[model samples]
Target: MVIINPTISTQPAALTRPAGPAPVLPADRVLNAVVLGERAQHLYELSSGSLRMMAESQTPLREGEQLQLRVLGKDAQQRPQLEILQRGTQDISPQLRNRLPEQLSLNQLSASLNQIRQGENPTLRQLIAPLLSSLPRRQQLSDSAGLQKALHNSGQSLEAKLASGEAPKGDIKAALLKLLATVQAQSPPPPKAGLARSYGPSNTPSPSVHAAGSAPADIATPGTASTAKSASAPQPQAASTAPAYQAPPKPLGLPGELQPQGRLPPSPPEIEGTLLSRLAHDVKGALARQDANQLLGLHSREHGGSYMIELPVRDRDGIDVWQFQFQPPRTERDHSHNERGSQHDTTQTGWTLSLSFDLPGLGAITARVTQQEKQLGIRFDAVQSDALELLRQHTPELHQRLAEKGIDVAGIDCRRRSAQALTESSYSLSALLRDQA
Candidate 1:
């Protein structure tokens, strides 16, 4: 006899495989692709993973920058002819949308790092200590070389360091990512059970049940004593043996463990949290914030706008987060830095460095330093009278230090910061610098 089995079917396989047809891109449908630089002059290579085509872009496009495109139509060669909607990082619209919801304030991250020296996790402490040590000391800001070093290690050039195929060993962002991964690995796996179950409900029942069926053949008859006494009577064969069922002694949260029918220990109103876990959360938030800042910087670059970096300086007292803003010359936007070179470095152009931070004895202070030729103009604003006086007293020493580095300071100006100072800094940095002067 022939038998046909219905246990297997090719229908399931057919359902899983997608229909053998190409995806349709309707005309004028918005698409996103990365610009792969110039093919020839104004012509650019644009790709959206599955497709690549060349299109002429009126606006200059940089390689590896994402572009928002709209499908206009196909060319005579059947290649996609597209219009550039938004260029360069989608103008970072996507980043702001995704990152802002998850980001925590940088101040919280600094506080967490401050507690690291006292952390019990030696592995975590070791991971971050090296990065912190790489940061420039406050004293290093007195000269140009040290300032450049600070800029390199500020975590702002982290992407550049990676793109250049160099190890970002001493970079703060790299270390934070490492720490985040380590801490995340320690998170307990989620419980897999669907619901509460009795003692090892997932385990197999014992084979002892088979023992009940393995009796002598004559045992069925009570009056078979005569037959049992016969010398030729067949002996009973042994049944397969297996260990009896045993309930595992694991906690309720663990897999295949029994959920006891008793009251559990009540959770407390508040409990002290672990340092490593807390630090992990803080690091995650800080990284998100960094991602947001980098996005903002990408959008600002086209306009020759300023970029801000928060440098956390750890000291004997505590960690202090200093904000530094660097603004390139306005003309620098039009011409590439390499192309401009010595021509742009002339005394006619100037660069601005603005700093804001708080000190142990001194109150909140802000400084704006402008460089023109070999000469520098320093303007400091302080909220406290004592802080202003102290800065004024140290102006001559600051001037002397800069002069030693061939940085001549025409004058050092100290002023009292007003209530409108924060307001001014938020709106126009130029105005803030002007008001300080």
Candidate 2:
């Protein structure tokens, strides 16, 4: 009877209490930021050398522009340090004032409006950076004025840049914003998307008249195509549920419930081929004329000495058949190559060409044709396995050398080593002709 029960914990009461309802989030305020482009600006300074405003007020503005406007405090090095205060839109135009949507917070409106202030930006990038930053935050804003401001900023920036000698930056944000504003301002919002009845005098029908209960004769009024069609053609009885002004079941291609399906048929092959060929021809011409100077110009980075013809050989017909090749070798070795050689063996590469040209015609024509061959070599303690294989396949001597270095000749890719012994130990008949010349 004296044993204490160990069932209940001491903190049981604390764990039983209920938590309060989750806190509600505050509603987001609407914002509108104007779109703009970066551009150069002419700034005005007071006699004290404090930036008063931008010299050109026609350009779209940016946050950097405000920096340009502020008086700078001297730094430790006596360099000007920028300090900026936020600006509002009391000085903006009335049209823009009217365009500002009432739902936007004052801060949002001011921020948006200030982005397009004239004379503030020197570059479109500077002007539009703020607006571009705001796009990812669009859901936070609630009003159309922000949208309008963005549009106005973009349009003004584009116009100013165009008037200036500088090219347009083709900023997509500005373009889109201006386009949206133009559409909103020029095109009326679509009529509310429902059946709207216009009220008029009792004798006059509603603007959107419907005759749900009317007979065919009642439905088709005089001086109308419907009336004439009903009179001429035997018409099926209209559906009981359908109104007299049910828009005649919408003709083919009209937007309605009965939409045709399946994708459009393929274009004709002949027409497509002709168009493609014409386009190819046009592209060839354009490519041919494009940047003619670039074609003939030498690559600046690959500078080497020029090549010139020395002796010209002509045929019996007075036409030039061939010319001697001459190029002045570079006097100095590349410094970069010397550095690389410190770490690795410097590989020497060179090319030689064997050429013959034919001149067959009457006026001292010399018939010549040219063939070219190239050889490359590198000095290494051990060549790459792939290259060694090629050498072994080409030359037994190279394979034997590789074997001396403990490499297998049977595993090689080449027929044999590339080097060859002199043939007949004498120059060929063609070489003799060139030597004699």
Candidate 3:
């Protein structure tokens, strides 16, 4: 049986301070890691070369699991803290395959644009030649202007081509797709200012019509001799020579069509609502099936929002009761006022996911996982030190279970909290769920 020390002292060693600055690890720096062993409070001792440090994780790690970790910062004793970034090498292949098609299209567009920008006389006509015949007959008359201009600029015999009727229709659709991608990659010129109107015959004022007394009284007094004379004059026959406003030339592609930007648009309300609904349904299904594996996959802590899931996993000791609570996405409005009537801002973008479990011999345990920006932090309640110590002994198993559900265990922290505080926290979560129901 493995026994873990209840507490480890972390005070600075008694020595004169080194001159200059403390050597620090770069933030979010990635390092390859291998699990060495487990220590107190579910912490795993990890190594990279001569560097050895402890990391706390909710997910268990096997004795020799290879992993990548991003350095967060140094703990109190100056040991580097790291968060898991990725696991085994093969894990990312499927995700890359899912995105391969889009990546390929983007690569092609980038290459073509780079060639054009370098002034290479690429076969512009040949590039779009196949697209000409596939255009709808009606759209051909309208949308074919850009194509015609491109061909003409390339000195290609467009009329002769039409006469020959040799355009390959089968490749037209594919050519159009490529052309669309290229156009989207290019940045269009800035829009021209709107037309300016010229007032006719500056020598004569245009007739000023207004509601009675709407203008200043002096301007409204048209009956005055000078005003009547000015109004009655033939207005110099109003030179009738205003320049017509001409619109700026439209870009080569469809007029007034904005090129698609790279960023994704926000999800529509219906889609967001559907996602939440589906998530609820999936969670319910997982629970009904009594599948811890499925339930683990259903926990979405990234997007934020309340989620509850039960994990029923048995170890050598007994069945453990695992409960998860995810705080709803908190917005700026949520932090505008605290009980003290002062304004505060929460810089954290990600929500919190709290895990609570009951170990047969170790009493209650709570682990709070928080992600701020890209950094991950895990904090355990200090009231249940024994539970955490016991967990440390089973670190490998815990890591494996969490990994099965797609959760990455990062740095672990232990903080003291009173029983009252735990109760208050649970109450808030309970209230949130009740309101949502």
Candidate 4:
């Protein structure tokens, strides 16, 4: 064996290799994308899918795998026109199905996919992916081939027929030449307001839907002829008379008789108590004066299916109380708010409130609804232990539901952020309000 230099060691200083392809993305990482169109384009990220950077030759942009979109120009309406530079793998979603042209055959689409997969010259894999997924689910290549062939043949025949026409007759040629000369001799005319309808008879009446009017051989019913004659009359004034109103009555409503609406009968007076009104009053009083010290004792429940009492505490200085008004059905307060069953009126508070509620099947979770200008924004708070566990274990299912509504919640670390802030739970609000007053 050869003697190695003691200073150099056996490894030869381990030659460093350049970095390889990027690691595959986790399902929760949001992948940014740009949708380009003549009208409007969107730059967004898909939060719940895998993304991969393909080889440069396979997908063109100089960046190789990483795709960056450049917005070129805005149309008259200020919509963006975009162009993509790199290629990345994107997830197929039902929403992306609209990118394909109407009536594209599945076979043609498959061929297009093959072209993209092969990374051929001038191939656009990124552009092609959206179109492939968007084709109508019901389309079949075998069925469409016959129709496509017929159309191709018809186009060829039409071109041949146009080419095979005989030379124009002497008189016809002379007349056509004269007409052309006259047209050329005249100055271009100003555009008219409307064009005349040229396809059908000028006075053509709307077709009678009945079978009798469809064919000349069919015997006309007693009043059908008269009705047709009256409809075709030239005098508008006569057509507007009582005699013109003698058209046949329409068939009785639809095939099925109108089903009576099933509105819930009114609840008993005792069941519809003043609890909601009382709760609203307390919330309104605390929010209007911005009094943090205000507190209210409300009946609530816990996640273990036990009914308990909850005390809502607002900490601030105030003897001030305000009357609260409840708008009708549309504006009725939603009391099933939190695990403690406490409701918060952020709209009146100009702040955000998180309340947890224990419900069957869902266990417990807090819904944080914020008041922003004139609208109320709602989102789930991560306080519910059971719900967070479900989310962590079932990421894909959660993502699918959230994606349906275009929500990209990929970066949320639920386990790390699902703790509730500790606060004093004294439900004795009425006595406190009295003391402050």
> Total clashes, candidate 3?
6
Tens digits of per-residue lDDT for model 4 on 1-437?
01111122222112232235433433222334432211111112212124322211111121112344443443343333334444453221111111110111112223223434344433244433333332222222125573243222211122223224423222211222333343233323212311111111123222322321221222221122334654675532332111111112111110001111011122122111121221122222212111121101011111111111111111121011011111111122445576777775432333444443333334334444444444444455444567667757775675566578675543433442323231112232222223333
Give the per-residue lDDT of model 1 (tens digit) for 247-316. 2221111100111111112222211124444556567666876765565566557556766776666566
Task: Please report how far candidate 4 places residue 126 from its true position, in Å.
Answer: 64
Overall lDDT per candidate, in order of appearance:
0.53, 0.25, 0.38, 0.27
Ranking by lDDT: 1, 3, 4, 2
- Score residue 302 of candidate 1 by CA lDDT: 56
Best by lDDT: 1
Global fold similarity of model 3 (TM-score):
0.24
Where does candidate 3 have its weakest 10-residue lDDT segment?
A: 250-259
Q: What is the per-residue lDDT of model 3 for residues 1-437, given as tens digits with 9 covering 90 to 100?
A: 11012133322223332334333568667778777655543456667777655555545554455788776766665655566678762222222222211121111222222233333334443443343333223223234584343323221222233334435333322343445554334423212321111111122222221211121322211111234655685533323332222211111110001111121112222222222222222222222222221221222232243544333322332223344455654655445767889786655457787765444445545677787665566777735667656656666676676678777767656665543344212222122223333
> 1 or 2: which has the higher TM-score?
1
**Candidate 2 deviant stretches above 4 angstroms:** 1-55, 58-60, 64-164, 167-171, 189-437
TM-score of 1: 0.56
* Per-candidate TM-score against the hidden true structure: 0.56, 0.14, 0.24, 0.16
How many angstroms is residue 223 displaced in model 3 relative to the true structure, after the best TM-score fit? 94
Candidate 2, residue 54: lDDT: 18
Model 4, global lDDT: 0.27
Count backbone overlaps in model 4. 12
Best by TM-score: 1
Relative to the unseen true structure, what is the C-alpha lDDT of residue 213 in candidate 3, on a scale of 0 to 100? 15
Output the TM-score of candidate 4: 0.16
